[model samples]
Target: MARIAVIGAGTGAMAAAARLAVAGHRVTVYERSGTYGGSLGRYARDGFVFDTGPSLLHLPAVYRDLFVKTGKEPLERCVTLTQVDPASRHLFADGTAVSLPDASRAGVVAALDQALGEGAGTRWAQFLDRAGTAWDRSRRPLLEEPLRDDREVAARDPYPAPRRRRLLRPARQAATLAQIGAWELADPRLAALLDGYALSYGLDPRRAPAAAALLPYMEQTFGSWYVSGGMRELAGALYERCVLRRVEFVFGAEVVRVAEKDGRAAGVELADGTHADADHVVLGAQPGPELVPSQAWDATGTRSAGRAAAPGRFVVMLSLRGAREAGAVHRTVVHCEDGTGEQEAVFGGRIADVPTVTVSRPDDPSTRPDEAHEAVTLTATVAPHGPVDWTDPALRERFADVLTGRAALAVPGLRERILRAEVRTPAETAADTGAAGGSVPAPALAGAGGAFLRPGNRTALPGLYLAGGWSHPGGGPAHAGMSGALVAGLVVEGDGFRGSR
Candidate 1:
């Protein structure tokens, strides 16, 4: 068995370690945070718990595979999955609203057709049909596996077998813009598609890649799911698996630099001056950590290196008197950012006079005496603007007001819903988390230059392999897990790892 060292104890790193350990490799995960969850870490203050990171859980099967491969049962440990109707809504600036559906979401399509037009439903159905095809073709190639060594994999295991019409079919040809424009409808459906895409690359539908055309169908058709509680459950589940496998987790240990020998990464040295060695090293490569080497940052300097990370929550955790939706664990209340103002500021990297909130409500059992409601998690995306004192007392209050104003734009008396509110900026996030500038899974998504630009899973340095968001397969939670699995696969197979199945 290989003595493997998986870096960063977050979702991506943990997933890689779990997959490797199950595969019979001796894996040890090193996490800088005292807690196991990366950005998925939870912040519980008083009686309320807030997900410090991502809220929604999509692509449930990717996570389920982790348990199944390890000989564990996800259903045994977690709550059953539920498909939410009105998966999300877009309240347009002109007061017209559009709702996105999932899995034969005929209702949403019907409702949308009224606002958009008579043929809107059929147009969406046609778009989804095509989107499904693209999703199948690119799922494994573009999203599941790393792209760096893609040609080699395609030459071998062309997943799904064309007969299955699998999304993970074998193929090539760089995913380009010309491809996405065909389906990116400009009406309400277009906005729905863009919102999902915005969750990843910050690219609006019109600007998003044609390869990403499947964005809507992925949620509406395949289904967007929710865990019993929040997405934190998935992270905790993975962490538990690591312990069960006897993997060591080293948290609160910040990595200072990646050591090199003869031009290869040899090991890592922590900020506390302790050194550790591994047969291999994989970076969770979550957002801020990528900028560590200084060399990791391209010519755009510190700012642009982190610019791609769309700013996330200024969160509000509410323990309401009652909830209308029970066991309905997932709901994202979308707030439109008008074309002229705050929305542009937040999306364009400018200071928003007001913030844009995407409220996430989790399942709560005690919201209404004997009844229950989806516990509420309100998150407003706010910019990290100029010259604010990192330690200033005034920043939180200022941003809270900013978020409150933005919330009023959509939900009236938004402040009344907040049992307690925490205004977290990028700087504050970096302070609590070791990740510099609160960069999560470090823009693992390669910008431009396509696949060649991202570092390969196997780095130039020997005994070092990259997993998580930073690796060739690119970013996103599930994508991170698959990337880590690929790294573990390589180490297990050794030179033959790059060979064939």
Candidate 2:
């Protein structure tokens, strides 16, 4: 049996450790932090609980499969997974509101038509149909399998955009997501809806490829989910599963560098001036020369190309004195009026005057002290830490106020109802995640000349592999889990391992 050493206790790393252990490999995970879960963090004060990471989950089948493969107990047995009805409520700039049903195209269409206009639903339905086509074309190479060297197949945009004819101009198909919204959806409100999806994932809709349409298709088709306690419970469940598989974990054990023997990854050197030898290594953190001595990897050709300037999230956690209103929508998005200004500010290293905000108020009692009180979370995509000085008290308070003001649209008397407010910026994210500039990585896309694809799982080093949000197939819970699976596949079945059937 090969002794495998994994760097970091993040979701992806832990997932790989469990799988490798189940395969009869002796695996040990070293994490710098005192905990697991990486971005799936939780904060609690005065009996109020808040999920510091992703509030909702999409594509839960990834974790479901992991649980099944690792043990007999399915995911549901470990955590309560409930499909959120009216998946989300959208508050448009013009005071128009619509609540889309979960995983129902017909229901979403009807709701859009009722709120936006008669033709709005039909236009959106058609757009999603095209988006569905993109999902089908790219699902295999981009998601289901390990990233291949000949990326020509995955590099090409799979989105079958409708061709449009302009006066005295040759017929052209939409390239960017913005183009698809304008050319196909044909409504400012509809376009904003589409842009909201892109921004939530840290993608600039203006530059994101048309293939990004698959995001909404994925969410709307698979549906949004919520755990009974919070997303943190999911992490706890996975961590327990790993322990059950006999995977050893070392908390607060920081890996300083990847050790090499005869030019192959042999083990890891810890920050405490210690080393543990292994037959193979899986790196889940951000790759760098200090960690991996290999110099053959090119950051420019992978998702790390934009790591320095990637977008991040600004979160405001509110403890309200009043109980959640009956029939309150679980998730509500307050759309910004000026999409261009918001995009330019977020990407151009500035803060927008008014930014799009997502408000999550899950109908779960565990998050509050009692039914008389409620916990609410507001999140917005913003410039990463380098561009914005999130450390400044003035800046933090001002931005928190801005987000809270926008959230007032979703929560009645929001400012008055708040018993306490806590703010978390990219700076906090950097501290918790150890990611440079606190920049969050977006999921990999299949267009823009392969600019959006992440680095392959297999690296230049013979015995070293990459896993997690920063690696192949890119970020998000589902994609990160897939990264772990791919890393295990490559290690167990050798390089010829294509993917799980």
Candidate 3:
């Protein structure tokens, strides 16, 4: 059996460890923090709980596959995963509101038509149909399988944008997400809705490829899920599964470097001046040059070398004094008044005057002290820590106030109902995840000359592989799980392993 050394105790790392252990490989995970989950963090105060990271899970099939492969118990037995009905409520800047039904194309189309106009629903449906084509074309290469290095194949944008004729110019198809929204959707609200999806994932809609439509397609088709307690519970379940598989974990053992022997990854050197030898090494953290040697993985022409700066999330957790209103949607998005300004602020390293805010109010008793009290979270996509001073007290307070003001549109008397407020910024994210500039990685897209794709799972180093948000298939809960699966596949089945069937 090969001895495997994993770099972090993040979900991706643990997932790989469990699978490798099940394959009879002795695996040991080294984590810097005293916790298991990386971005899947939680915060509690006065019996109130909040998910400091992703509030919802999309494409849960990834985790389901992980559980099925690792153990006899299915994912449902480990964690109560429920589909959130009326997936989300959108409050437009013009005071128009619509609650879209979960995973129902007809229902979403009808709601959009009734709320916006007679043709709005049809337009959205058509856009989704086209988006489905993109999903079908890119799902295998961009998500299901290992990332291919062929630039021609990776650079191909799978979005089938319809050709549009112009009065003074030649016919052209939409390239960027913004182009698709303005030219094809033909409605400002629809454009804003599309932009919101892109921004939430740290993608700049203005520059993000039209193939990014697959994001909404994936969510609306597969549906959004919520764990019984919080997203952190999902992490706990996975960690438990790893433990059940006999995967050893070493908490607070920070890996400073990947040791090499005869030009192959030999083991890991810890920050405490210790080393653990392994036949294979898997990296589940950000593959920074400091951790992974430059010679092992040259970033010269790879996707890792030229990836754009990703945005970070600013969160405000509210402990309200009153109970949640009956029939309130679990998720509500308050659309920004100025989309252009918000995009500029996020992508251009500044703060917008008014930013789009997503408010989450999970109907779970575990998050609150009692039925008389409620736990609510408000989040916005903003510039990462390098550009914005998330450490400044004034900036944090001001941004929290702005988010609360925007969330007021979704929650009635939000400020008055708040018993306490806790703010989290990119600064906190940097501290928690150790991501440079607290930048959250976006999912890989198959467009923009392969500019949006991430580095492949395999590296120049024979026994070393990359997993997690910063690597192949890119970020998000499901994608990270996929990265772990890919890494395990490579280690267990050799490099010929394509992906899980």
Which residue runs of candidate 1 sit more than 4 Å off their true CA positions? 75-80, 149-184, 192-196, 199-201, 204-207, 262-264, 286-312, 322-330, 340-344, 366-374, 384-395, 405-414, 441-454, 495-501
Off by over 4 Å in 3: 299-302, 306-308
Candidate 3: worst-modelled 10 consecutive residues by lDDT: 299-308
Listed in order, each prediction's TM-score against the native is: 0.79, 0.98, 0.98
- Pairs of residues at least 3 apart in sequence or in different chains that clash in candidate 3: none
Candidate 2: the clashing residue pairs are none
Compose the digit string of candidate 1's lDDT tens values, residues 46-120.
455666666666667777777777755664465555666557655554566566666665776687788777877
Q: How close is candidate 1 to the true structure, as a TM-score?
A: 0.79
Q: Count the backbone clashes (under 3 Å) in each candidate.
A: 17, 0, 0
Model 2 TM-score, all chains together: 0.98
CA deviation > 4 Å runs, candidate 2 = 299-303
Tens-digit per-residue lDDT, 1-501, candidate 3: 999999887777887888999999999999998899999999998899999999899999999999999999999999999899999999999999999999999999999999999999999999999999999888888888887657466689999999999899999999999999999999999999999999999999999999999999998999999999999999999999999998999999989999988988999999989999999999998887778877765841244655545789999999999999999999999999899999998999999999999999999999999999999999999999988899999989999999999999999888999899999999998887888778898998998898888888888888999888888888999899999999999999988998877
- Model 3, position 319, has a per-residue lDDT of 98
Compared with the true structure, the alpha-carbon lDDT of candidate 1 equals 0.56
Output the better candidate (1/2) by TM-score.
2
Count of backbone collisions in candidate 1: 17
